[model samples]
Target: MIALPFAKSGSQSFLRGDRVHLRAPVGGDYKAWAALRAESRAFLTPWEPLWNEDDLERGAFRLRIRRYQEEAQSGTGYPFFVFRNSDSRLLGGITLGNIRRGVAQCGQIGYWCGVPFAGQGYMTEAIGLVIPFAFEQLRLHRLEAACIPHNKRSTRLLEKAGFQREGLLRSYLKINGLWQDHLLYSLIENDRRSTTNNKGAR
Candidate 1:
């Protein structure tokens, strides 16, 4: 996993991993981000919220960066873009958002990988990078994620990453313009330690 420290000031973080690195979104990334999202629209539309007509426009991208910064400053969210380490190509995006502190100490995680990079384990490693950030730097106690029931790939990914299925949420999220049933999953700070301990005992 990447070892770079997260600067609370929202400065650029170089979270490097084996094949991918994660960093905060920047205005300069507009072109590559847009092209990848545009080309992967068909591949991604099924799982994501409906995109606005101007979602990929430069102006919209600018506002997105602003919102991300605002959330960062407020200590409620963090958004990162995944890039290939070899050439620094944009591969995907991930966000640990809606953080709740003051006892809850929890957050939600979401991500997407462009079609060209899908199934290549980039998002998986990207997820690994964020888990530590959420649990250690942010000191979050729990992390939650949900996806449509039919998205078997996501289910497998979450499970492989040690997230346990919590339950089903009927009409949980609007995806591709329709309400869909989503299966919720969660991981807590102790789960990692328990797994490691079990491995040692074995």
Candidate 2:
């Protein structure tokens, strides 16, 4: 991917953590993004919805970028590409979608890591960065995530990042071309704050 551009004032638009940074995807990211996803197809397919044959094509990617930009601009959702801070390598992606305002200030969080990057702490760190962005910048009250019961890695990642397992949903989503059950998890703003406070009190 091309180097991310900065504003003339030099403020960073991307969310930065110790090991990774989250940035909006650009047109140039198509190549690297496609390659990474293609390489990790088997690893990711099971947890994700079935992919169309043209899913990795540039046209489809461009459409994705456009939709993400629109969503971000409209405060409906925020999409980010996860990159390693040391080398700026694209590792995966995370998104806060289905944002609801007014009476319900909540959004759904989803993420994936490349096969090669799996088992590392990259995804956990990425979630840490996104939570602050969702709760602080977006002023959201709660973030929800769901994972297949069999996806132990994802379940562990969510739990490690402080999400509470709420329950299980039967045939909750269509993943890998079939309806699958998911374990629901959520992190509320007050819960997060309490956790932080408790840690600081230690």
Candidate 3:
């Protein structure tokens, strides 16, 4: 098992990396969360599903928190909000969703970084933190991620985090306002172990 060196909580599962920490979203985060999303609207909207009219409102955030809590309580998914460690500023969010257990033992990884935080490696560190959480804490066999084929930044971040490109998913998800193709990538437990071993051997 991989040892998580930084920090982790018992139930809340707050993850801490060298530069960032992730905790489940709560009602109190509404203001800062809304502000970041509003500022990064143009950078994020194109890659995300169409947002509701009141998506940034407090009521909507509360509803979203409820949904996330339900998903976690049901053991179907886990969501975390990424924050900068230095000043505790909100940077973005990441989630391990659509979890499948039994024979599959897999889950999908999804995330978004605010425009100002993009290209600064915060998302990469966030994903690095989640990998162990998925493979060790959750005991998931595989983790999958998908991004639009032309999204170079997303592709780079995934590759940097050790995800291997699998295939193109034709019209796999509805992004913004239209269905679009996506590139699928995955990192399995054995693969992660092998990578770790190789790095250690070198």
lDDT of each: 0.89, 0.89, 0.90
Which residue segments of model 3 deviate by more than 4 Å?
1-13
TM-score of each predicted structure versus truth:
0.92, 0.94, 0.94
Model 3: lDDT of residue 20: 96
Looking at candidate 1, the ten consecutive residues that score lowest on lDDT are: 1-10
Candidate 1 wrong stretches, greater than 4 Å:
1-12, 200-202
Model 2 steric clash total: 0
Residue lDDT tens for model 2, 1-202: 1122322222353889999988888887888999999999999998999999999999999899888877877778888889898988999999988899989999999999999999999999999999998888888999999999989999999999999999999999999989999999999999999999999999
Ranking by lDDT: 3, 2, 1
lDDT for each residue of candidate 3 in 23-54, tens digit (9 for 90 to 100): 88877788999999999999999999999999
TM-score of decoy 2: 0.94
Can you list the residue pairs that collide in candidate 3? none
